[model samples]
Target: MKELICISCPMGCHLQVEGESVENIVVSGNGCVRGIIYAKNEITAPKRMVCGTVKINGATQPVVSVKTKEPIPKEKIFDCLAELNNTTIEAPVSVGDVAIVNVCNTGVDVVVTKGLSKR
Candidate 1:
């Protein structure tokens, strides 16, 4: 059996999953559509959120916040981080700039969340 927490809302729904085809799912705490999506993804192909700091050249803090626009394959999370950690970018970054493209080959890109200018 597999367990997953629904991040759809404040009421985190706990889902219990079983079976090979993932049809024998038993969920009791789902509160809405978002929860259903979470459960389905959890049983079949679980994904992970990527959010961390990327080094920023000439910055006061030397790092800028970044996150994947979409959930990436959980299995490739480590690989994604490996690439991200190895990357370095200059400041003057826009909020929607693609910080890391083709992350883990999961067709998801990590991007900067806030603009960072050289100071």
Candidate 2:
């Protein structure tokens, strides 16, 4: 059995799950069906959004904020960050610009969350 707190909604339901596989798992203490789904996903294959800053050359600020375009496999996050750490973007980048393409081969782009202009 596994215990978890559902984060899929604002309710924050405490959930208890039993069974070895998703097919046979039983969930209790969920206020809504979303909690069941959240538990299953969290247990089977977890993912997370990556957000951080990378160095930028010639920008007003020395660094720019960036985030993964979509949630990536949790295990790939550090590898993704390592790639981002080695990256340096040119100034004049705009919001929504792609900072790193298919980062860490996860098929997700890292995009600029804040725009910066040349110094």
Q: lDDT: which candidate is best?
A: 2
After superposition, candidate 2 runs with Cα above 4 Å error: 9-11
List the candidates' TM-scores in order.
0.84, 0.86
Looking at model 1, the pairs that clash are none
Clashes (N, CA, C under 3 Å) per candidate: 0, 0
lDDT of 2 by residue, 1-119 (tens): 89999987788999999876789889999999988887887888877899999999999899999999998999999999999999999999999999999999999999999989889
Which residue pairs collide, candidate 2?
A: none
State which candidate has the highest TM-score.
2
Looking at model 1, residue 40 earns an lDDT score of: 77
Tell me the lDDT of model 2 at 50: 96
lDDT of 2 at 96: 94
**lDDT by residue (tens digit), candidate 1, 67-97:** 9899888898888888889888888898979
Cα lDDT listed for each candidate: 0.80, 0.92
Q: What lDDT score is found at residue 116 in candidate 1?
A: 80
Off by over 4 Å in 1: 1-3, 16-26
